[model samples]
Target: MDRQEKRAFVAFLAEVFASTSIVIVTENKGLTVADVTELRRRIRATGSTYKVAKNRLVSRALEGTQFDGIAPLLKGPTALSWGADPAAMAKVLVEFAKTNENLVVLGGALGSQTLDASGVKALAELPSLDELRAKLVGMLNTPATRIAGAVQAPAGQLARVFGAYSKSEAA
Candidate 1:
């Protein structure tokens, strides 16, 4: 690669490391072009990215970043999957790997903490930010709904009682 190309790649890697919440490393040795394209599609659907860069460049880019510890995992035929939501990226990688044996998850770095393959899988099981937010909103709404029903109960009972009393008088 030309010097200009190298510089551009380093800059791109730096941007990715800066913007992402987690960086997942994988060894994509024998994955076909179609398989990679499919994986990229799935990752893009979740607003993340899948990239394969030189290990040296990755290590250089990782230096001084929160994902510095992941440099060790960059030694082999590494591909990186990363995004704002760690769970989403992990989920995609794990789900894709389930069907594609060529994609082997090595390890990853979340902030300063490095994680093994199992750790990445565990992360995949966690709810995403949007799911967690939806749960929170549901919890918040439940009490309000119950409160409204409780507040209306007395009036409803009063109306029912008046209706019954009127029917009895007519009888």
Candidate 2:
């Protein structure tokens, strides 16, 4: 690549490292083009993306970024899976690594905090932001649903009682 292209790519990587909540570094060595394509598809489905950059370029991108701590993990056929959702990339990489032996999980960064392989696994275990929000909404709605159900029950029973009494009188 030319100098201008390199500068643009470095800037783009820096932007990615800055804006994203989480980025998982991994080695995609010997992974077939089809496998990488599949991984990208899966990542996009979750509103995330996978990128492979040269180690030197990624290291340069990390300078002055919160992801500088992750520079060590940027070696050897490194590809990054990143997204707005902090949990998504770690979750996807950890799961993919489980099935694909060639895709080695390197440490990553969630903002300034550097995560080891085990930490990445732990991150995968945490509920995603969306999942937590859904859970909170469900929790908040439960009481209202129960209140509606309870309020309707007495009226339903009263109607049933009146219907039974009327039928008996007619009989």
> Would you give me the overall lDDT of model 2?
0.86
Poorly placed runs, candidate 2 (over 4 Å): none
TM-score of each: 0.96, 0.93
lDDT of 1 by residue, 46-159 (tens): 888899989998888888899998887887688998888889889999999999999999989898789999999999999988899999999999999999999999999999
The prediction achieving the highest TM-score against the true structure is 1
Worst 10 residues of 2 by lDDT: 84-93
Candidate 1 vs. true structure, TM-score: 0.96
Q: Which ten residues in a row have the lowest lDDT in candidate 1?
A: 69-78
Best by lDDT: 1
Q: Whole-model Cα lDDT per candidate? A: 0.91, 0.86
Model 2 lDDT at residue 59: 89
